[model samples]
Target: MKQPEIIFILRGATGAEHLALEGAVNLEARLSDPDRRRALVAGFYGFHADAEYCLAPWLEPVEGLDFAARRRLPRIGADLVALGGKPAPSRERPTVTSLGYALGLFYVLEGSSLGGRVIHKQLSHTDVDQRGLSFFDPYGDQTGAQWRAFIAVLDREHAAGRADSKEIVAGALDGFRLARMWLTE
Candidate 1:
């Protein structure tokens, strides 16, 4: 059976998602406290900074896909400071290059915002979470719109025969593994 490209990517990433969620348990535990939230945000900042830096060069030239506009590092950094913590430094290296590769990685990164919304809701009333949830849902009310736009672009790319489902899956899988390692390590 044929599936939408996004669906295909999602199915391919099931294992990676499970692996990444193992690390998320720690973050989930920390969200109950303000100080721990700071450390959690710092850890997230480090992971994202590295991923965004590595993917930016390749994704920059893609129209309607401005990597800068989508970045959470600056906000994450500020959130870390507000929480009385320094921004965590990225220790991971770039794992993929090329536009196709970046897009695949982006699928995982951008998809995270959807789940972030759920977490944001859970933490919305907390003082620290209120201040730091920007990394989770940078677009706020516009998150759905932004996700739809990204999916639209993916559809277009697929229709134009520029999308490589396998590469995208590989990117997403690698992204998940890398994120898990960074968050836990």
Candidate 2:
């Protein structure tokens, strides 16, 4: 966790995007009910898919495709973030997260086997979570002592290949852009 603090200066992994996700997850868990907390997580994802940082025009190549068709969430997440679309923030839950967790999880949950799987493998190696759902939501293993290791693994992953390629990084950028729009608005 401390390692990424410096890297945050170079990129979004540890910047406002990371903070937003952490804030949302922390807030969701604090909510009065468990079910509502889960739904709030979903809305966070919905809002994140529509953020301007997504720069929909940049994703012209894979606009109609899934980040990872094999995974249920990323596949469905693709269309909801259509070109020229903005987040609706249209959920009926008692509380709404600022999309912090949603953005944070984008590191792993938003893409195809190429990048997403890298994070997924890290999560597996660390043994913190087996579900691959993510610590992005308050409902998952986002909290507690174990999360430390999970986050540490993320830092390691980011530090190793923070900017390996342009397209991969750009895809990640969209998730954060959506997160900022969802929260501040």
Candidate 3:
């Protein structure tokens, strides 16, 4: 049988972890409270900042992918500051040793934008000030396009034998686990 696409494999491998992280996030409840929302953004900055720092070097050589443009640290930091929280120094550096692994970890981070769009929409209907909400809707109208582009790069990397499916799945799972631990703490 033909192998499944990397994205499909990642989704299947990470389904349970994804659900667990979602439960931990409790986005609706968190977004409803100012303190919780600030904490949430601060957690995001802690996670994404470290993840970006770890993955950037590995992703630098990937052709057709502009890794810098995908960085969310600045946006997360801005959101945290807007929410009156200081961005903390990097705590833990998640291991991203290879291009394949970096791509896998990136899959989880980039995939978050999809759900973030929904959260951004929901927040719009609330009474909360929108100053700190930019991170959730970072792409504005280009979210779908950006996701498609990332997928294309992922597929290209896999097809080029630069990334192994197992490594990708493992990275995604670790990404979810790390995200949950950071966000929930």
Candidate 4:
């Protein structure tokens, strides 16, 4: 059987995502400072709110999918308030039309929670977490299981040839690029 397009995408997008992560927000520094941490959280919330809003119509049709469960805007907002910051305005939105492209953006969004586990661990050692960690630790102990479930779906989509590789990859790349640019601002 042919390898799933998701596999190729994971392999191909790693470098680009890494570059984005490196140049994006300074995770370590932000964790140590309450003010910076609030800024980081708010920034990410704005970006995700805009992205998810654009992708909502496309993603809602996927069965067994819960957009509210996947959303972190509320948590980020709460965290910002806890830290005495207001939720900023939404950022520039991405254009998404197809399910394949929508899933591609979701790939980036869900994968972020996977990465968030690490940040969550780091934040736990600080008082900042008392403020809020809904964004970083949205799934809490269920993070791994949620990720596996999402991957299973993605893999199935690839195996069933339900998605177009070009569109998926384009969405993923666009997601990474825009997120990185947003964080740097």
Candidate 5:
């Protein structure tokens, strides 16, 4: 069996990005608090029975109301304060076509480091996993050469300081919180 530390070491991100992970042991319950719930709703998570999913700011075809409105539940988006840079796109209802540019491609799509292996390792094979839970998981199918070229872009962005550890951590939390809070609340 793999030890927790071993898995953590394999995650390939810096420690700062995983700082909140310790809190997740408790955050699952805290995420249900009414205040946090309100924060989530205000942040634009739409509800579905036991899961609240983000509409990705650019991907349409999401299957729920955009607001709580007494008819649905909501979840929080990233806490930009903690994310360190790059705020989420605004809440206006411009056409979906406009959203890709409005939100920026990097925010919506990962070129090479799509969370594929990570998602599989984390949720698959867990006892209570509900399985098939990663419909929103990131994916990329380019050849190795193509992938290398793509990762170079993320590297450039990082070198330029356009992206950072804090933003990655906060957004990852928002993603899971938006999903798991539904079961608790």
Candidate 6:
């Protein structure tokens, strides 16, 4: 039998965690309040910082993938500050020991941009100041193309035997867990 695509595998394995995280984020409630918005951005800063640090070693060397440009920690931090919050002095780092695991983690991070686009649209209708909204729409008009590029890289890696679907799914689950924990805390 032919194997399922890695993206499909990741989406299936991470479906529950992703839903839980979305519920915890409660974008409508959070976006309605300035304090809540700052807190949300701060939580994202913390999670992205740790996630990026974990992914660097594994993803940085991947050709055709500009991992450095994909880093969101800095933009998240800027968003937090713009929203009148500060980054935590430290955060718990998730362990990502393999390329497959890193790709799994990245799948979660990159996939978030899809939701971010929706959140960005929601925020547009809110009274919240727009300065910190950069995190929600980092790619602007290029979001689809950027996502396709990442997916291409993922497919290439899997086809080349550099990553395993199971490990990638596990990484995605962990990523969702980590994101939910930080966001809800």
Which segments of model 3 are wrong by more than 4 Å? Answer: 1-4
Per-residue lDDT of candidate 6, residues 29-121 (tens digit): 777678887888888888899999989999999998899998888888878878889887556788888899899989889988878987787
**Residues 33-72, model 3: lDDT tens digits:** 8898898888899889888889989886677778888888
The TM-scores, one per candidate, come to 0.85, 0.33, 0.93, 0.87, 0.28, 0.93
Per-residue lDDT tens digits of candidate 5, residues 56-167?
4422321221222211221122322232222234333222233222112222223212343343444445543322222223232333333343344434433456534344
Clash count for each candidate, listed in order shown: 0, 7, 0, 0, 2, 0
Give the alpha carbon lDDT tens digit for every residue of 28-117 in model 4.
777667777777777787778888898888777776677667877777778777777876776678989676677787888887887888
Worst 10 residues of 5 by lDDT: 66-75
- In model 6, pairs of residues that clash are none
Q: Considering summed lDDT, which 10 consecutive residues are worst modelled in model 2?
A: 93-102
| Candidate 2, lDDT over the whole model | 0.38
- RMSD (CA, angstroms), candidate 4: 2.6
Return the lDDT, model 2, position 96.
15
Off by over 4 Å in 6: 1-4
Off by over 4 Å in 2: 1-14, 27-32, 44-66, 74-174, 180-185
lDDT of 1 by residue, 61-92 (tens): 77787778988788888878878888765677
Model 5, C-alpha of 145: deviation from truth (Å): 8.1
lDDT of each: 0.73, 0.38, 0.84, 0.74, 0.31, 0.84
Clashing pairs in 4: none
For model 2, how does the per-residue alpha-carbon lDDT over 1-185 read when each residue is reduced to its tens digit?
25454234326543555466545554423223444433443555565444322323322233232223213335324333432223355432112122222223344333222332344445566634233134233223322333344345445444455323333344345554544444432
Q: In candidate 2, how many Å is residue 128 off? A: 16
As a whole number from 0 to 100, the lDDT of residue 50 in candidate 4 is 82
User: Every model's Cα RMSD, please?
Assistant: 2.9, 12.0, 2.4, 2.6, 13.5, 2.5
How does model 4 score by TM-score?
0.87
